[model samples]
Target: MTKLQSGMSRRYFLQVTGSGLVTATALGGSALQARAEPYDTFTWISPRGTLEVLDDYPYWSALKMGYFGDLKTEMQPGPSDGTATVKFVDVGQADMGFPSPGVFSFAIENGMNLKSVFHMGARDTFSIAFRKGEGTRDLKQLEGKTILLGSAAWQSIVDPMLAAQGVDITKVNYVEAGWPTWATALAAGQGDAALSWEGLRAEWIANGLEFEYWLGVQHSTLPANTFVVRSADLEDPDRKAFLEKYLRGWAMGLEFGYLNPRAAVEAVYEQFPTFASNTGPELGTTSILQQINVFRGDMENREGWGWHDMSSWQAFFDQIHAIGQITKPVKAEDVCTNELIAAANDFDHEKVKADAEAYQLSEEFAAIDVENIQAHMFDNAV
Candidate 1:
């Protein structure tokens, strides 16, 4: 088996990796000591294509900032969807993966003993996007309308969202299509509405389309994405302690992103020049800021960052169970654990938040409001 070599830079984390990834020394079990552990190698797989994008700001930032301590992290960009990510983690092809709850649940039923350690996007980003003036305003509006879907897994979200609005699923027509252009199609009256994740919000602006969308979080009790590994890993005290330190740095990167979104975007653009896309800084920074809002959702109020009560995951499991995706009631307790994340937040969060909040931006950056996350979410969204 190939191992991730040392001296690997953060910018190229996703580019190269041998067969095997990481093996680190352990730390104390109970107390979260602010000590870094050294690891020969480890593999981390990204759910998305590259770290240059907005959602992955934390990972890229952490790498550049040396958050992994001495771990030789071999990062790989995942293929197509979370399914590949789940499989990679299941078979040991990857040491860890960031998978959605749906994918994570599926793996559990398939006999993969996985556990979630981090919650990346607490609020659900999945939605049905429509134009501002004529686009869909609510989930109830989807009745008798043609909606474009991304994949079969989306039904887990589509069915429940419609049901929550008291709309019958049979009344809606679902058509599968590729994204980034669905907004244009909806604008041209090709469909009544289109399914969207917040990530696609940038594409809407890229195409100069006015849009507002519905969030799955507002309508359901489910989270968006999380970092996961084998359930067995938690059995090892050293491994678990190492995760806590890693999360500490990861959280720092996320907070830093909020403090200086423009700098974060610029850093990624400078590193992965191909991701620049020539969209210019104003729009890119705005997109990155929009994503930052989602990352901070209810984190302060919840059981710290990445921590969640089982009740929060119930509705999602119930919805998927009805659609035959989950055969029986998948107990949230059996599927996920907040032990590591709870420890990850043991550090002084107030300092991180204050630092980010205090970061002053240049006029060019200040002029662009990060709060205007949805150009179409509200008439006065900004």
Candidate 2:
């Protein structure tokens, strides 16, 4: 198979398993009639700043498409830090928020009652990018070399990737770095390597940097970015409705994005016009379509579009516990619930698959080439 074809096959296999599809009842009249109460409005918090693409894009699409019209959602923006977002949810300032699974693992270790409802990206898109001539084919080569990282959570990710390759992190020199300053720090020769996401990889490559990636190894332990809610909120009927409706709308929005790349690109650009100037229209458009394709292509045919697997969850928690990231063993039951995702199963799965496949073959998918594919797939923008 050609590289593109191989990529498509990989995409299909990942979606089939990653999307978490389980055979279940549809949200037919019987399911809807079973609800005993009326829906109420709820507030969701997303990270603030222009980088809202990861957290706010789906919500924005849902709102634009009237996905949450029935539940009446009010979105509030919070700081980008996942830990801060968790605090906002804990204090009841927000009913729901976006946090990386690493943050969730940290909170659960500390005995926080957090639960993740949706999986934002199918795979870990963050990586450690190194200069090409550095002889750094693997993490082991970094032994005794200084590496830059943004947060402790990043260590959780890097630790395992290195461990698997038989490299001990204790042997490496670690530097605490700020997210915004990481790219420049590496380019200026201040750090041997930088922990980065796909977007940063694209930016670096565009600027003439030669680098190889160490894609987010977090998925080997935990889900990447997930929509999390406090455990107390799961029983609320409105909260349930909000999640169900939101997922449905999100699935649709993803499909819409896949089917209409130019339109989706315009929508994303409209929301974050600064990208046009910084990355230019061509690269910006490429970045957005890559994300849309990866998300839709990998998740379209799965049983749960954004639900976590029980085995995967348990394995992740086990790893987190071993690393001292959590004080106690975290259970799958404690961190995530399938109630809402199970409810979404009532919608048409075959139709969802068909739409997603059509999207994979659309012009938007075709517009992306392999080298740029990795970059766009993880673009932080919508």
**lDDT scores of the candidates, listed in order:** 0.63, 0.55
Model 1: residues with Cα > 4 Å off, grouped in runs: 1-40, 50-52, 179-189, 217-220, 348-377, 380-382
Best candidate, lDDT: 1
What TM-score does candidate 2 reach? Answer: 0.73
- Candidate 2 local lDDT, residue 57: 47
lDDT of 2 by residue, 177-236 (tens): 765566677777888887766444555555556566655533233355667876655676
The alpha-carbon deviation from the true structure for residue 219 of candidate 1, after best TM-score superposition, in angstroms, is: 4.7
Give the per-residue lDDT digits (tens) of candidate 1, residues 118-194: 87767776677776665444666678888875554455556656765677777888775543345577777787777
Tell me the TM-score of each prediction against the true structure.
0.77, 0.73
Q: Lowest-lDDT window of 10 residues in candidate 2?
A: 1-10
lDDT of 2 at 14: 14
lDDT of 1 at 87: 60
User: How many pairs of residues collide in each model?
Assistant: 5, 8
Candidate 1 accuracy as lDDT:
0.63
